[model samples]
Structures are given as structure tokens and as C-alpha cells.
Target: MADPHIKSKMDWLDYVTVIAYRLGFTLAAPAILLLPWEVETGIPAQQLTFLAAMLCASSLHIYMKNFRLILQAATWGGLICAIFGFPLFGLGGAFVTLGGLCFKEYFCFRVPGLRAQPILLAALWLALVLNATLTAPMVVQGLAALSALLFLVTAVAKWRMPLHFDIGDKTKYEV
Candidate 1:
């Protein structure tokens, strides 16, 4: 029998990924309220949040052959766009990656509130980008708040799960 006390390299990677993932969302949850301060101080909370999120996404170990690769590509593509001054595309790509993660979590664990995350995140970004008069500022804020809460809940639940759960069956992974 495998010793439970023995921590594999995958275990360490999962712990680190979870920490980064949680930190990213924790920073993001208060983003709407912090926007004014971020703007005033030029702290760039949005960039930092995305950076951490990218790290988490890039490091994730998916059972499928190419799913993790696809996610990392999308994440890098988004981050590069943001760094190159394309904020809209950058945010869209990053959120899509995050939404993908949420979808994966929902599929794997059937976590409540996760299934709506992708739609909610997409809508939130679209409302901000379009600046639609029909979508009031308060509505945008409300969406942001809702998204933040859902993300926080998901992150917390993921953190609480067993480290080995993230690793899954190594034999099933494509080498």
C-alpha cells in the first residue's frame, strides 16, 4: 500500500496551484470596491489578479490529453494581449479560461453555483466593455459582486478538497 505520509511532487504542485487560485479570486472578490483605490494608486490589482489566475490555470493537471495545454495557451494569449494594451480581449480570454476551470469543477464535483459562473463572468465583462445604457452601473456592480461571491465559494471549496483529488489517476494521464 502507498504510504499516505509520502507527498509526491504532484501533491506539492496541487497545493501551490490551489494557493495561487485562491489568492487570485480573493483579490478579485473586492475588485469593484477597490477599483477607485487601484486607479488612484496605480496598484494594478486587475493585472495581479489575472497573473495569479494564469499561474493556477497553467499549472493545473487535467486528466485529458490536451485540455491543460489548451487552457495554458488561452491563458497566455490573454495575458499577452493585456500586457500589449488590449484590455478588452485580454480580460475576455482570461475570464474564459477561468470559466473553463469553473466548468471543469462543476463537471467533476457538481458544486452548486459553479455552473452559472461562465455565463455570469461573460455577462459581467460584456456589460463593462459595451457600457450599455440599458445596463445600469449598479447592474454591472451587482454582477461583479455576484461573480466575486461565486468565485470565492468555489475557491474555498476547492481548497478544502483532498490534495490527491486534484492529481487524479496518474495512469490515465497522457504521458
Candidate 2:
């Protein structure tokens, strides 16, 4: 049986979001790894292998959409860790979350819908990415926290959502 909630149409907007999401993640994943590496190792010349692996993993979401949700979650988690952890714990903190993300996304992404909708995730990704380089840290932290909250709320709701969650549709829970 197929899941009703899963839709993979070829809408133009989907193309835009998918491209942006994939490209952004591809670029971001390497930085997520390399930042701490450079911080500790002072920029190794042979880091391309790690970067290539990250790129491959990022692109895997396209063919294997089931685990994409988990991947998305990890992606956000990485952003959170890198943005906040980098400043707080330095290299170790950054690698901790980044490594956890890669491990989970690579091994456990098929666990279920533990991720928010792709569209919402894309917006959050944009928020984290754009704000990550700002001069002010507080603003980025605030946005990252909000995005994580939003993702969690939507994800939980998605899992526990009433069957008839369509727009204004009423369900037994209302009665």
C-alpha cells in the first residue's frame, strides 16, 4: 500500500525548492565538516575526500526520498550545532553535531516522518544559511532556535496529526 501523505509531483515550484535545497545542503555540508577540521588541523590538503562524500550523501536525498525527512532533520540539527556550538565549544562541538547528523541521516533516515514538510524545511534551511554569516550572533541564534521549534512542532503534528488535516476539514477529534 502507498502512503497518501507522500506526493512527488513534478511541479515547477518543487523543482525550485529541490534545487535550492540540494545545492545549499551540498555546499553547506562540506563547510560543516571543514570548519572544525580547519580549526583543529589548520586546513589539510587532502580534505577533498570528505567533501566528496558529503556531496554524495547530500545528493542521495533525491533518489531516496523516504529517508529525506530524517536527512532534513539532521541538516537543521547540523546548522544549529555549527552556528551555536562552534562559538561555545569550538571544534569538538561542531564535529559532534555534524557527525551525529551524517550518521543518523545515512543510517536511520527511513525511520518514519520525523521531519517537517519539505517546503517548510527549505525555508528554515534558507534562514539558517543566510543568517549564519551575519556580524551579529544573537540574531542568528534567535532565528535558528525559532526554525528548530517550528520544525519540531510541524513534525510532531505531522506524526500525530488528525487523519483529516486538510485545510478546514473537521475530524473526530473536534467532536
Candidate 3:
């Protein structure tokens, strides 16, 4: 069988993606660390949820060097946040659900062309809007928007290449 693993066509866009990925992680790290660990009834569990979300976002960004793993982690993480977070953080959890949608679209539409990027980007936009509306902190809202934009731009710039590079011939999952 021929190998389906597509090598990244190294270019400025690839470099930009790496940088953007790193930047997203950097921004998400503080949010992860600062998230509240506990909450009282009647008080919004926003801090704790944000912390968990930040952890997932930063962790996923770090491990996203592998495309398949990135997809899986993002999907699972997003689902977890949506299911567990909604009760705890309300609309904030919905934003996480939207993020999962973005990651799913990114993997599902992985094609050797530029079309897949916009779909994924649209998902990111949904997430950003949700976050902006739910979270009161301007810093976090700004960071989330900037990170989403950066990743979207990076992915769009390299839409004609495989989303990640791995050498193999097995079909672990189909995009």
C-alpha cells in the first residue's frame, strides 16, 4: 500500500503555524494556572472552569505536533468541557463545545487544498463569540480572540498541505 502520510511543505506558513501554536499555548497557560479550584453555591464557577479549559487548550496545543492525536485530544477535551462544564460554568462551557466543533472540523476537512481552513475558522469564530459574551474579563476575552485568529490564519496559510507530518501507511482515521 502507498503511504498516505503527507509531508508538510516547509514554508513561511509552516513556521508561522508553529509560532502561532506556541503563542496560543503561552496565552492559555496563565488562564490554566489561575483557574479557581473550588466554588460556592450561587457563585459562578467561572474561575475553576476557565482553569480546566486553559489546561486542556495548552495541553492540546503542545501535543498537536501529531495530527491524529491532536484531533482526538481536541475532540475529547472539548466534549469533556461541554458535558462537565455546562453545569459548572454555564455559557462558558458552551464555548468549549464550540472549540470542539472547531477541532473536529479541522480534522474532518483535512484536504490538500485551502477549503478546509475556512470551515475550521468559522468554528473558532463561534467559540470566540461565545467566550466574549460569557466571560467578563477583557484580558481573557482578548487573548482568546487573538489566539483563535492566529491559529485560523496559520491554518489558512497552509491549507494546501497535510495538517501534520507523520510517516505511515495505515489508515488510523479518515478525514
Candidate 1 local lDDT, 26-126, one digit each (tens)? 55556533332455578875676577567567557676757777766777888898889997678777777777777787777677988898898788778
Top TM-score hit: 1
| Better lDDT candidate (1, 2) | 1
| lDDT for each residue of candidate 2 in 26-105, tens digit (9 for 90 to 100) | 44333433332343566641133233223333433333345444444454444454456443322222233223333343
Best by lDDT: 1
TM-score of 1: 0.80
What are the TM-scores, per candidate, against the unseen true structure?
Answer: 0.80, 0.27, 0.28
RMSD of each: 4.2, 14.8, 14.1
Candidate 2: lDDT of 16? Answer: 48
Ranking by lDDT: 1, 3, 2
lDDT of 3 by residue, 1-175 (tens): 1123544344665455444433433333233223221122433334433443443343232223355354435434544655674432342442343345244434544523224433443443354345437644554444445444534443454344343542222233343
Give Cα distance to truth, residue 114, candidate 1, Å. 0.6
| Clashes found in each candidate (C-alpha, N, C closer than 3 A) | 0, 0, 1
